[model samples]
Target: MEKSWNNRAWFMVLPVLVLVAFSAVVPLMTVVNYSVQDTFGNNEFFWAGTEWFEELLASDRFWEAMGRNLVFSLVILAIEVPLGIFIALNMPRKGIGVSVCLVLMALPLLVPWNVVGTIWQVFGRVDIGLLGHTLEAIGIDYNYVSDPIDAWITVVLMDVWHWTSLVVLLCYAGLVSIPDAYYQAARIDGASRWAVFRYIQLPKMNRVLLIAVLLRFMDSFMIYTEPFVVTGGGPGNSTTFLSIDLVKMAVGQFDLGPAAAMSLVYFLIILLLSWVFYTVMTNRGVER
Candidate 1:
């Protein structure tokens, strides 16, 4: 006998589809509309074809911001992924300390983005802030306000402090999910600590590691709030990522057409890069 499907579930999904249509699809369409058009004033829009896109593509400012974004994302991934895995490996596996460790690891992730930025902004102040005061006392020149390198370092450090927790939690979950049988087998084989991590834990955590890398990369690439709050994309646009540049174009300069075109291109770049990351990681997993 053939089984009947639950057609009522479609009714449950209708609300979600409608929500997405309004929230995502509608705004996307609006951006597309503006991207290919120019405006003078009073709701006047003129068909300009791909003029905005061409201009944005040819702009040096756009490429410079793109380069900054790529570098920041790479640096974030390099630091966070390995650091997270190491922290997870050291965490108490089975004890009362587990809950405490998890809570501590989650604390930073729970902070609001803007609040995190604000905290760092104040904390890094050289005159009154503890970090700044301490650094000054130690005879180190630490000012995120005027120095480009210092601004970059401050932004990168703030991001790591805020988001590394996410990677840690993900990796910890992956580590804990490995069954005791695997550990027991490894022990019976008299495997070294490095060997166990290499052959067993690493493979088990591959999926979660992939997730951590992708999420970190995307978040770092699109970082805006903290850096904006701290540096306002200043220090000569040293820490300005693509998101900050896009916002500066759209709101600061009111370049609607170019901003819209840039937004679409930004979305496509993210989508394409994410797809590449997923495909390469998944294929590697399959091969392994």
Candidate 2:
């Protein structure tokens, strides 16, 4: 006898679809509408075709921001992925210590983004902040507000502090999910520590590592608030990534046409790069 499927289950998903349509799809459509049009004052709009897109494509400023974004994302991924994995590896596997480690790892992730930025902003002040004061007392010139290199370092460090916990939590979850049988087998084989990590733990953690890398990449690329609050995209645009530049165009400069076009392009670049990362990592996972 053939079994009949219940179609009513789809009703449970309808609210989610509606919410997504309102929250994501509608705004996306609005951005697309603005991207191909121009407006003056008083809500007047004119068809501009691809004028803004052409200008953005030809602009050196756009390329420079894109380069900065790429570098930042790569640097963050490099640092956070390994660091998170290392921390996870060292974490207690059971008991009260497990809970302690998890809670500590989770604290930074729980802080609001703007608050993180504000905390760093105040914490890095040369005269008042502990970090800057210590550096100053040590005779090191450490003013992120005045130096481009210092500003970059501060922003990068701030991001790492804020988000590395996410990577750690993901990796830790992956590590814990691994069955004890794998460890027992490795022990029976007299597998070295490095060998066990390389052959067993690494493979098991691959899925979570992929997630960590992608999350770090996307967050770093689109980062605006923390860096904005800390560096204000400055020390002469050294830390001004694409999102900051886009905000400058859209809100600061009030150049809606170019900003809209740039926003659309920015969205596409993120989508394309994320797709590439996902596809490549999934294929590698499948191969292994």
Best by TM-score: 1
Please, what is the TM-score per model? 0.91, 0.90
List model 2 lDDT by residue over 1-288, tens digit each.
999899998999999999999999998888888888999879999999999999999999999999999999888888888998999899999899999988899999999999999999989999899998999999999999999988988988898898889988898888888999999999999999999999998988888888888888888889989998998899888988899999999999988989989999999988998999989988987898
Off by over 4 Å in 2: 1-21, 284-288
List clash counts for every candidate, in order. 0, 0
Worst 10 residues of 1 by lDDT: 234-243
Minimal lDDT window, size 10, model 2 = 210-219
Residue pairs that clash (backbone atoms under 3 angstroms), model 1:
none
Computed on alpha carbons, the lDDT of every model, listed in order, comes to 0.92, 0.91
lDDT of 1 by residue, 185-226 (tens): 999999999999999999888898988898999888888899
